[model samples]
Target: MSAVLAQAPAAEAVEDLAASLQEAGTVAAPPEDADAAIEEIGLREKESDQVIDKSDKKDPLYAISITSFEDPALELGELILKGLYEMKFSRPSKIQAASLPKIKMGRNLLAQAHNGTGKTCCFVLGMLRIVTPDTTPQALCICPTRELAKQIEEEVLKMGKYLILHKGIKVKCILRDERWERGERITEQIVIGTPGKIVSLLNMKVLDGGSIRMFVLDEADEMLNLGGLGDQSKRIRQRLRKDVQTLFFSATYTDAVKRLATQLSMDNPWSQIEVKREHIFNDQVAQYFYRTNGVTEKLERLTEILSVVNVGQCIIFVHLRDTVEQLANTLTANGHPVSPLHGRMEAGARDKVLVDFRNGTTRFLVTTNVLSRGIDVPAVTLVINYDMPVRKGGTADPDTYLHRVGRTGRFGRKGSALNMIHDEKEMVVLKQIEAYFDRQGLIKEIPPDTDGEEFEKILNVQ
Candidate 1:
């Protein structure tokens, strides 16, 4: 039967070729062969040209040539120029370059860029241009988390150090736990704080909205995700005048966030910008993965990693508060310097942990996603995902995965991300993540006793 099948295929092929030659009045080729002949004669050359032109026109910057900081069109006050020089900002990032010009024109802006691309500076600079020393809360910047609010305040202060805004124009941080006094009006030119705090102050008539000429929302997507919509953001907006120039900035924007931003800005034409790089993973980061089961295996693998990797500063991400404390204790007992941070911790305790980490007193900080977004530590060289984040259908989003890895890489420095997955189900998720990033399998099995000098040599660990 196999011989007959093979011989029948040859006979059929001969008949088919003869039939093709007779039909064409010449030797006819397959459909694909005809297509190749047409293409070889340049029949589709005009179509290829049209495709190239379409692509070029679709590019965001096709007609827009970004101006350098020294461009004649770029204008700045003397105080602002001094502040920029003091902050040591030599050049503007892509977002900064694109948005600053429009912002200087006092246009409402909605911008999207990757983390660490300097979106914070773009809005800050824009606010500085609009805010005067006598202006009362002329610019208001709201962030999702208190940590982010505090960080933004610090950056604003640093960038405006040479200016007299700190003394002439007050900048207050409205924390959630703090209550607004009766006469404690927002007399500052710039106010930076969390949405909850700002909303509370506006509700209590402590934050005057009449003078708010410019509004900035940092991490706009996160603020909406945290449920900062309802009365707080709405009431705050109600107090602002109709002419207020609004700006929304975020690392990533979902459909919901975009809708919220559009409503806030009265459907202004938003500007979208992105900085393309070859790889999202930082080159300075030396990424590695290990397979482990349960808490004991996790601790063992972490111990092995810390013992070998020369990590000057590290952040360990955990899914739960209990795991954070437990890992901190275990690492401390194992002679590793570590600290714990979580949402459940008191505000003072969290502040102290951050201070210690910044001062080099704490070498390792284990926390949840609270430190993932706005917390910036330039020295963080190692980031370890001790436990995979629980997601819908036992799967996590790729954006969340990227944010977790983003903590370590900052200010053009190298960073590493180490993921731990033990079971086949988790391995399946890991494979999906690899496919999302267009990468091959990232998870590897570390053999037992893989901690010797030979292992170090294999990994090129010094």
Candidate 2:
């Protein structure tokens, strides 16, 4: 077992190196000379310039002003402006400021912004501008997760409540299980759903995409990672008219995601606006790691930590579905009010777990990676990683780790992420993650069986 264990890290290192080398080689290659390539392809400089100009305008992050909603005279309908005012949204977030003007113009957009920077509202407002009450599914928003889609739908309804009340414009959420019957027309002007459901509806001819003037992909990177890019998005695009507008939004811009955007938009100009690195992770989150000797010791330390910490709402992340269930059951049996959330649960059950956690009925949510992205439970004060994520099979990227921890410490609220690592291998991965963030001081060694007072002191719990 020791020999096998020693070989495992070596094998992983080799694989990591090979993947890095492949990526490096690709990046090191020279860009194709545009003039020669265009001439060979029988394209003119004028046409090429148009493409270049468009690309320059669209370069994913261009024209993004630091001032969000700075101009009081920005054009908006009376009802929309009223809604924004009512929602107390006096200022635009970075993403909303950058993307809204272009999106309102019905141009295709590819944007990358951090989570919780108000990317949803950017697309929602854009959708509202183009969609009229009489239109049938004029806009479609596809999110990677059902939770995110539901959340976006709820936000849209909230923002457009006055519109619905005054104008009778209906917005609907189409989940994976629910579908419009064949020959039954869509009455809603705006539709939001996961990719699978949207594709199914499109394939069944129940969704008429020719009428879809706008398409928005929220959390675009996750859509590609989940393997829905080729079939769902491509098929939906094929069904839409040539001039239909497209918007892609994501927190991180991985190479694969950039490639997908380029391919989908016919190499259209894109904007790549990135928030400053310092603003990526919430400074309010007091992140710390506790090193333990083994799983039993880790659990013991976790129980100790929980006993001392004044946790309002907490999420404990584990690697496997079974582990989530086991931990939840263990905590529940030990008098901790806990609920388990995983992909294996029925959608309704999973949603109930979220609702309970959000409503403060369940203080602790034991979950897998399913809840890592776009499940914003703001009241969650602590995120505890009970098991280190396995980076194999692309299951646990740095983005995933960040998202997991990001569950807490949201919206400028003080929070904490307590990582429980038990071995050298786990520590190595944690180091890699810290390096990714340039946060070397975040991890600290904990003595075995740390007392409540000592632990609190270490975590800086007031």
Candidate 3:
């Protein structure tokens, strides 16, 4: 996780940050509508639609190298800058620097950046900037899962805390099993949820789509490709106002995905800032892979690593729900406390597991891809891919692997990624991923001959 979205700053840190900003004289006086923070938004967009809808041909890598919070390109207001200062955001991330200018211009953006690169904050800032704090749904964000939706909702609330305290600003998250029934009003300034739930709400007329000024698709590739979410997402977006700014963000972008996203942008043409796949892996994570004989050998190797390595916290990723059950049961029976999360589990059960993991009460979490992309847990010093991510056709899944390894390296802290590979076939896939990332030199092989001293040094925190 990146420092930008890993966790909320401590209360004392927040105060210290505020003091530092005040001393620097960058903090502005409270707005005249201090009670509301922001006035009600007008019905139409304030920017010219035609100019923003054009595609951007700038170098994607160069586009994201911005380091200033008050970059003139973003065109953020003084009050928004003040709120950002209070959040202790010392600088804009590379992705933020690249996309904020397009965002401020009201462009229909399709951006590709690695996980934890402040993608969530980039869109949250855009949403907060456009929202008028009125009772209508000015902005809507769609995620692939409930946990991710909640994560986005949490960040939005934290970023907008000042507005809540001063102007009574409201943002709502529609999670699993929650519904906005017909005849009931949805009067939040911002709404976030899974695509299905949002579409259902729209069909029931619970949400006034015409009033939504911004539409954002987080994890755009997954929301548009997996399951039947593409149709549902399209339905939800089709209902929004014509000139609404449409945005997409994901870690990977295929040619098909780019074309689909462009088509989805509809009346507004599309633009993108794409980082090469080989360059997305976080340098903070020290990656390693161990070769084994088979499934039994892989588990044995994992158990050995767990027993030998000193980790602040750990997560083990499997590919199937049943594997999660078997591995969790086996580990617990072996006297290692752990938790399991998967798609089939009830929402309440998943929530409890995540809460425990995030609080550091549960040090180890075993799961499928459910927690791969967006959920952030504290103190995760190790991430083990017990079973490598691959598609049903046995093809490499670089995107899934990237997100899984991203679970560690929290808040710019150094961490370890251990890939457990069994057999030549799996080894080939591992090499493919290594080649895909151009990380042959960065990722090392963990030979069995290594003494405990060498292994311990590998896991040692800097």
Evaluate all candidate structures by whole-model CA lDDT and list the values in order: 0.64, 0.68, 0.73
Q: Which portions of model 3 miss their true places by more than 4 Å?
A: 1-54, 57-67, 71-75, 451-453
Residue by residue across 1-462, what tens digits does model 1's lDDT show? 011110112334434433432343221222334334332321211121111011134333222323344443445555666676455554555566566655654456677666665678788877666666674677898876677788888877776665555446456776777867877777777898876777777767788877787888887766666343434665577678766788878766666766666677664434444433224433444556667776578678778778877766888888889989988999989988789999899888888899899888888999987887767887787788887655657775555666677776665555667777666666676676666656565444456566755445433323
What lDDT is reached at residue 51 by model 1? 10
Winner on lDDT between 1 and 2 is 2
Residue 330, model 3, lDDT: 85
Off by over 4 Å in 1: 1-65, 165-167, 226-235, 275-286, 436-449, 452-462
Angstrom error at residue 100, model 3: 1.2
TM-scores for candidates 1 onward, in order: 0.79, 0.82, 0.84
* Top candidate when judged by lDDT against the true structure: 3
Q: Residues 153-218, candidate 2, lDDT per residue (tens digit)?
A: 887887787777788778989886664678877779899988778877887878888788778888
Error of model 2, residue 314, in angstroms: 0.3
Specify the poorest-scoring 10-residue window by lDDT in model 1.
46-55
Clashes of each: 3, 12, 2
RMSD of each: 19.0, 15.6, 10.3
Model 2, residue 264: C-alpha shift (Å)? 0.8
Model 2 TM-score is 0.82
lDDT of 3 by residue, 1-462 (tens): 112111233445434433443344222333433212211210111112111112444422223333455654444556667676555565555567567755755668898777666678789999887776568888899988899999899888888777666666689999867745579979988999998888888888888898887899998888788458888888987898777788998877667777888887775644577666666776667898888888897786676666677788899999999999999988888767779999999999999999888888887899999889877764888998888899888878877898898887756567789888888877887887887787776668889676666777876642
